[model samples]
Target: MSRSFIIDGSIIYTNYSQIIGQSKFEELLREFVDILKEKQSPLLNALNAFKVNSDYDVHRFTEYLHLLTMRNIKEIGNIIYYVNPKDLERFIEAFYTFWRSKHRFMVRNEKYAEDYNRRASIEYTVTMIGDQFKATIKNLYRELMMNVSNTFPTVMRQLPSGAQVMFLIQEPNGEKYRKNEWVTKIPTVWGAIFDPPAIFYTKSNKRRGILPVVEKDILSEIALDPNEWYRFAIYVGDLLMYNFVHVEYLAHGAGLANLFELATPKDLESREPDGILIFGLPADKIPGYNEKWRNGVIFKEEDGYTGVIPAFDENDYFGYMKKTTLTIHNLIKIDRGKLPIHGSMARITLKSGKSVVAMFVGDSGAGKSETLDALNRLEEVAQIDTIIDDMGSLDIIDGHVVAFGTETGAFVRLDDLPPGFAYSTMDRSIFMNPDQINARVIVPFNNYNEVITPTHIDFFLYANNYTEVHNDEERIVFFKNPNEALKVFSEGKRMSKGTTSETGLTNSYFANPFGAIQRKEEHHRIAEHFIKKMFETGVKIGEIRTMLGVQGYEKEGTMLAARALLKVIEQI
Candidate 1:
């Protein structure tokens, strides 16, 4: 039997035709165009296909397409034969029987229902794909939150513009995608190019991927909110100490490097963005919080990291921020060769709220050490002890002044020290070669000396003129100009000039009560009175420590000395 077939969409043409080629579906359109140009159809060549055009053909095509849409394999034909018959009833019955037998297996195939639901139309496939994209973006946001959980609740106050800062990241993604993909590089690049903020505060929330805590939160938490001072103090101290020590901003981990974007108040107000995070805090809460952070600067690494971090329950972020400012001071080499060996004199004000004899200057080999030696033995001198032999630091603390003396008290008994330590201690001195001195030519020099009291006269003289008291009258002068005062010393010969004595030829200025005692008396009065003048100036103990290179202590000592000096100034 040569069975008839219908092609509803387009005729399988050996030559191109109008509506059939144009109106066909895309795949079918291409097939029709190719077949028409070649004058042969791929379908016809492969399966011996033919086309029929009529209402009956159209009806048949529609019926077949519907079965195919349902994935009814048996209903589809492996071979369709062309037919011409005048007895239409007999032909129709035979055709229907053939169709029913061909589709029998398709009806029993379990996938028929499944194929109908899935391949019903193109719209269903597109809707499924859209849902998948949404889910991916949602997950990416979650991952960002998880990474930033560690530095959450970060706060800052009084931040300057254009300060580079960082956020903290705890859990980073280990996915196949690059970190940039997750962070959204395009937006980050735009932020950097247009506006950069001081720093970022971020933390990984366990449930989320990463969370960004930006400039607004920093300001409100620290600058605007009163309760958040402790948090503010922590970050501020980190900022200040980092700035002070490094003189530059510190970069945290790599991801944090890009994430920090701080904005200024002006940026925020204009809707331009002042900072990244903005908390709505009141104005009154600002000052106190700011002050707390300022004070937190005094805390050490341990205090800042351990005590403060735990206090706020923010150990992760706080632990990483550096807390102390580092300052290095270099000491000048002491000239051992120079004498009336150069004696240094600085005003020392004691904590006892009293000013006493402290200054000493001396001529080379003149017993400067001996005078100090004498004072060291005195109970009074022992009370207002020396803080440093040569150097120290001074810092302010709570309006009080304190000192760190590098050297042990001059009275330290060498015998009491361990043998190893005693060897290094500067407790003993050697004096020799007195006559080898160049006596005829004097190397004149000038220096400012610290004389706290008239009692300092003995020490200064002892330090200056030990072996020989030159005829130079060592007396205090009321004349303001020091050069002119020294000029008077240059011009003079002694009154009550010395005659030969049993010991040696005596210059009366060296021993005569009139010259020696008179000058001593004058210097004593000046020493006692001059200290009162110095009291008007602040002197500190920490200054003593830094000067002397005291062991294992500088920061604390500096603060104490500074405070002490201020107090003294106030009292004076």
Candidate 2:
């Protein structure tokens, strides 16, 4: 016996060997088909597979399986359909295509690429930032021009000494004219001119408007009349000086703003000028008597038994300081090669020799002021002319040192000074003006005080934080300690052959701190290379060379400093 059954419209059965007959099988097949047709009452071609009971049903099942496999293949193809990229393809093509929907892969044209980038918003933003800075300068200038026009009257009343009064028109040179012909011979004044106090009248011709003064010839005609000449100079000088004050203020404010706008505090602090002029209180006036007190300091008492102890209470007071408290003026060394202008703290080379120039620096405080005051006092006591005092101008002429102060003044000893001198005298050294009647009186104190430190040359060394760098590139040396740097530069003896050329032996520095010169020969070679580079770059030019020897033009001094600074590697 054989049993046959159909499941899921497919044939399944076991063949029997004994009872098999064609007529019987045919009959059974007809019966199964009738049952399947009854199960599906409605006639449907798609349903015909269900009514079938033959080998043909197997062929139908095979077709269905093939269709199901095709569906799965389509699903997989949809999941990971991607175009293959060529090995020669550039990243830019992929980048542009990723960013821009309209982009297509092709060889990019240089001109088109440039044009596209130029039109980008990022480029526009950069261009706008630059324009903004320029505009700020213009606005500042306009404001200054208006202010000067309105405040001319006030400025005339308070003109500073050393102020120059200029005129718009200069008098023409001509043959000598009689003093009495003043009205007729006087040049017509136009633009702006300073008014002379004196009429420049001859002793022989004493009439008003009768004698007129010509430029530079004002004193020649009246050699014996210096008093009158000086009076006339001041009157005219005042008028001319006022004219440019507003313009200069505007330019300075704009430049300074631009410099500080983007600078961090560290950047500003790190900016080392050619020299620094310290004007505030002396270092000894601070709570602590130590090198650490140079910047500024605070005092705090440790936990103790209730109130204060006698001598021990003094020891409890200490100082804490920040580097910013120090008042510093950056020196713009001006000499023959440099020009002078407003905002310039000139670093003038003394008449002293080059070796001395390397040592003389400007710093005044308890540690330095007292020691220098002693030397200066000795000269005064000995009735020896102390050639220079506060506010001296230095110039080197024909390899000779020349220094003369703005005016004669007294010198004070630091030891006799009251405690807390640093906090007491903030603007004595840098901003004092002789015309202001603000004379610094250095009265001789015969009395001695135990609180003051005794005189010692070593104080000048430790009180000053000196940093030296050798400019192998420019063959120049720089000293940074303000109080003693200039003095050392001015007085330091030439190093002997056996002395090592370290910071202690020679006060020279490479503006670039990271310069590599471990060996003596390497140092020499680097120096030569730097000198050659500087020469090629016009560092030897009159303006650029001012910083080379500590004395040069006043106007171009900062440029000199910046040039030398390009070689510095570290701060001392």
Query: What TM-score would each prediction reach against the true structure?
Result: 0.17, 0.18
Best by TM-score: 2
Model 2, 1-572: lDDT tens digits are: 11111111011122221112224323433444344356652222322333355322533332332232233323333443321212102221222122222101111101111244553533343234323322332332223233323222334222111101121211212322223232112221121111111011101100011011111211112111111100000001001000011121111111111111111112222231111111122334322234433322222112100011111111111100001101000011121221111101112122231111111222222122332322223211222222222222223334322332221222322223333442343322211111111122222112112101121110111121222223434423433323233233223222211111122223222210111111223433433433333333322111112221122322232233333322221121
**Which stretches in model 2 have alpha-carbon errors above 4 Å?**
1-335, 338-360, 366-369, 376-381, 410-572
Q: How big is the positional error of residue 282 in model 2, measured in Å on the Cα after superposition?
A: 30
Model 1 lDDT per residue over 284-307, tens place: 433234323321212112112111
What is the C-alpha local distance difference test score of each model? 0.22, 0.22
Off by over 4 Å in 1: 1-354, 362-366, 379-382, 390-463, 466-480, 484-572
TM-score of 1: 0.17
Each prediction's Cα RMSD?
35.9, 39.9
Clashes of 1: 84
What does the lDDT come to for candidate 1? 0.22
- Going through the candidates in the order shown, the clash numbers are 84, 59
